[model samples]
Target: MDHHEGLRETYAGEWQGLTNSEIRARYPEEYEAWSRGEPVRRGGGELATEVADRAVPVVLDAVDKLPDNGTVVVVSHGGTIRTMIGRLLDMEPAQWERFGGLSNCCWSVMGQGARGWRLLEHNAGTLPQPVIGDET
Candidate 1:
């Protein structure tokens, strides 16, 4: 298991430790943009791209060290994981919100592919069952 401080969640700035209702009540505009998946300065906190910029290099460095078909388990905060996955798949930062947040202790699986990195699973908690008889 590897740990990096860059894998921490996007800093919530003054909103840290506040409940969603409290944040919504206090910063309605920022909360609205956040709920709508629009990129807004998150209370002068780090942007998604900024999170990716710091975290992606660490992830890529780890990936580079892996042997062929090797696996690495990365444990990270929900937003940071999403940003890293989006960046790995070459998705624009604006589309990072398309990926949903992960539940506590849930995880995502990614694999390198010919085209680039591919996400085999996202926000998953259970082991995947193999397809049977073409049943999807």
Candidate 2:
């Protein structure tokens, strides 16, 4: 997810870390189109969509290995979390872009059930709500 190309780091020769305007000024049309679905052929870099594809399988593989009715906690970045949610909801890759971008220290709980993966609660932080026990 975040560690993947798009979010990881830009590797374009002379274009890395530059703003879009700077890239356009330096790299011309190729960089300008970077935001509008431009594919970073081979060594350039990967698009955000590509990163999600690489992340989904890793998450699913871990889930599959868990015992039925088992719970697992995934501590990761916003991109990784959103991508996982999109996969759980059976969303298309395009739709994955629309997943809620949760904040830091936030989490979403999903469950595997007869109806397949179901989203329980979204962005639940470590709060005392919905619980009776607390440090006395």
Best by lDDT: 1
lDDT of 1 by residue, 1-136 (tens): 7679988889978788889889899999999998787876677788788999999999888888998768778888998999999999999888988899999989998876566787878889886554454222
TM-score between candidate 1 and the true structure? 0.88
Each candidate: what lDDT?
0.84, 0.60
- Off-target runs (Cα >4 Å) in candidate 1 are 129-136
Residue pairs in collision within model 1: none
Models 1 onward score TM values of 0.88, 0.57
lDDT of 1: 0.84
Q: How many residue pairs clash in each candidate?
A: 0, 0
lDDT of 2 at 49: 53
Best by TM-score: 1
